[model samples]
Every structure is written in C-alpha cells, then in structure tokens.
Target: MSHPVDIHVGRKLKQARTLRRMSQTDVARHLKLSFQQIQKYEIGSNRIAASRLYDLSRILDVPTAYFFEGLGDAPEVGARDHGLDIVSAVASIKDEQVKSRIVTFIEDVSGRTVAKSA
Candidate 1:
C-alpha cells in the first residue's frame, strides 16, 4: 500500500509537472518510464522507491525534502504554509516563460519576505 507520504509526493510531482506545462508522456519519456507508471505515481497507486524519488526530484527541480516538508508534525512557528492553492495557481499558468517568471518572482519574494527563514 502507498503511504500518505507517497500520496503527498505524487501530488507534488503532478504539481511540478503542470507548472512546467509538461504532459505525463513527456515526463515519462524523459524519465524512461511509461505514462502508466507516471500515472500510478501521480495517483499514489504505487510507492516510489528512493532512487526513483531522487530522479523525480532532479527532473522536477524540487528539493527531495519537498516531499516531506511538513510530515508527522504540526506547523512550526513561522513555517510557510504550503497549501494546494499554490499548486492550483501554478497549474493555471499556461506559458512556460510565465511559469519560470513566477518561480523567479516567488524566489525573490521568499528571499525578502521570509528573510528570517533563510
């Protein structure tokens, strides 16, 4: 059975894929996996192994810790709330350049807005 962590990881994967305007076929081909495999990963029908998780993190350009950002604990003081809103907002972006710009914008804002978090 897939763990809650696996489900969260899948959600993150799908979010990143949509943010980059990439299709499951595209990501599957890039990762040398089948679209069905990608689907399974995205839906939490199967658990991703550690090596695959590393590959996913590398391919998605997200940190490995992203999958476990707030697992098994309450929110920390001042910890950034990572809601589904950001994922939906990212998925709504149509242009890749716009997405990149948004990412950069977030990075910039995070650098300033949460300076203490650094």
Candidate 2:
C-alpha cells in the first residue's frame, strides 16, 4: 500500500522533474531504470529507494529534504500542481537578477517585504 508520505514525495519528485523540463525517459536513462519505473515512482505506485532518492536529488538539483518540505500540510493534488506551475515559472528564469526581482515582487504581493541582500 502507498503511504501518504510516499505520495507526497512522489509529487515532489514530479514537480522537480517538471520544473527541470525533464521527461520521464530522460530520468530513467540517467538512473538506468525503465521509464515505467519512473512513472510508478511519480504516482507512488512504487516506492523509491533511499539511494535512488539521493540520486534524484542530485539530478534534480534539490536537497533531499525538499521532498518533505510540505509534508505536514499534505497538500492536495491540485495545490501540488499549482505549486509545480509556480516553480516551473521561476525555474525558467535565465538571469539571477531577474529571478531576484521576481522573488521580491512575490514577497511584496504577499505583504511581506524582505530586504534584498547586497
């Protein structure tokens, strides 16, 4: 049976992959696994082993803890997809300056203005 944490982590993996604009086949080729395995992992139909998760973190350029970031809330699927969309938008930024501006804008929109670092 699939546990809640597994489902959540799977969603995180999918989100990271999507933001990277990576296909399941690409990830599978990198990890030497079948594309079906990656699909199963994304859907939580198959649990990811710790070693594989570590590999994924490196390949996806996220910390291992990223997969558990919002575990407490157990975000709904729609919320997860929306989060992915936002992450994808941010990841598409090619310039650090532009990305920082977007971050600052988002902070302002959220009513919390954080000072920019020098």
Candidate 3:
C-alpha cells in the first residue's frame, strides 16, 4: 500500500513545479518519464520510487528531506516555506551560466577549506 507520505511528497512536487513555471512535460522529459507518470506523482495517485524521488528532489532544487519536512505538522503548519525558498532561490538565479559558475566556485572553495582544516 502507498503511504500517506506519498501524497505529501506529491503536493510538494506540484507546488515546486508550479512555482518554477515548469510544465509536467518538462520535468518528465528531464527525468526520462512520461508526462502521465509525472501527473500521477503530482496528484499522489502513485507512489514515487526512491531513486525517482531523489531525482525529482534534485530537479526541483530541494533537499531530499524536503518531502518529509512537514509530514507530522498540524494543519496550521505549512509545507510552502521550503518549497518557496527553493523557488525564490532559483528565480534569483537569472543566468544559467552564472549559476553553474557559482556552484563550481562554492564546491571548490568548500572542498579546499575542509581539506586545509583537516
């Protein structure tokens, strides 16, 4: 049986995708899946496989744990915060090339800093 968590994950996925102004077809193409599969996932009609979920997390620019963040929340607790954080961060990254350079720069700096401190 599919866990209720699947629905939560699906909702988060849908929210993130919509906020990014991306289509189900865009995500499906990136994940090498059919748009129908993406649709099923977004609506929680199907459970996402672990591997696919991980891929979705990356494509959505969220932590893998993002889907599980509000699983135990009260109705008052919102899942929109982290999803919005991702959307806002992504939107501010207006240049794809600059984004790539920034990621590479951060990775390199962090790697060297950690290595030197070790």
Candidate 4:
C-alpha cells in the first residue's frame, strides 16, 4: 500500500501541475524522465527522491513546502473537489487585473463580498 504522505504529495504535485496548466509530458521533459514516470509519481506508484522533488519544485515554480501543504487534513488521493481546484486555478493567475476581475466576478455570483487586498 502506498504511504499516505506519498499519496498526499502526489496529489499536491498533480494539483500544482494542473494549476500551472502543464501536461505530464511537459513536466517529464523538464525532468528528463518519461511521461510514464511522471504518471507514476503523480499516482504515488513510485516515490520521488528528495533531489527530484527539489527539481520538481523548481520546474513547477512552487515552494518545496507546497507539496506538503494540508497534508494533515488531506482527503484520499483522486478525490474530486472542484471548489478547491477553482480557487487554486484562480490564485495561480499572474495578471493582477485579471485576477482581481475574476475575484470580483466570483464575489458577485456568490453574493458575498471578499475584503479587498491592501
């Protein structure tokens, strides 16, 4: 059985990759590994080494700690949570104007006002 931590990390990896709009093939090419290897990593079928994890953090433009975020509260791997995915995708937007507009739109649709960022 895969360790829960491994599964959590794999799920985070997939989340970050998807939020960045990267395909497994793109990540594999950067790591010089086969796409199947990337799939294995994402599925927790194979454990990633620390060095490779560091490389992945760099490639994915996320802090290494990002892979461990919410590990204590994580759900089972492959669980569907579209709300979190949507938040993550919105958070990953680089353009401030676009992000602000999206946030406004979300607030309007939800009938809630989010505090403006200083």
User: Distance from true position, residue 27, model 2, in Å?
Assistant: 0.5
Tens-digit per-residue lDDT, 57-117, candidate 3: 8887778887788788766555355645654475468797875565457559757321110
Query: How high a TM-score does candidate 4 get?
Result: 0.66
Residue 24, candidate 2: Cα error in Å is: 0.3
lDDT of 1 at 106: 76
TM-score for each candidate, following the candidate numbering: 0.63, 0.67, 0.61, 0.66
Q: RMSD for all candidates, in order, please.
A: 6.5, 6.7, 8.2, 7.3
Write down the lDDT that model 3 would get: 0.72
Q: Which stretches of candidate 3 lie over 4 Å from their true place?
A: 76-118
Model 2's TM-score against the true structure: 0.67
Tens-place lDDT per residue, model 2, 11-90, is: 89888786565778888999999999999999898999999999999888889999989789754676545666786687
Two-way TM-score contest, 2 vs 3, winner: 2
Residues forming the 10-long window of minimal summed lDDT in candidate 3: 109-118
lDDT of each: 0.74, 0.81, 0.72, 0.81
Model 1 poorest ten-residue lDDT run: 109-118
- Name model 4 segments beyond 4 Å from true: 74-80, 83-118
Pairs in steric clash, model 2: none
| Residue-by-residue lDDT tens digits, candidate 4, 1-118 | 8887887788888877765557789899999999999888888988989999999998887899988888777667988868557867876889979987887898799997644411
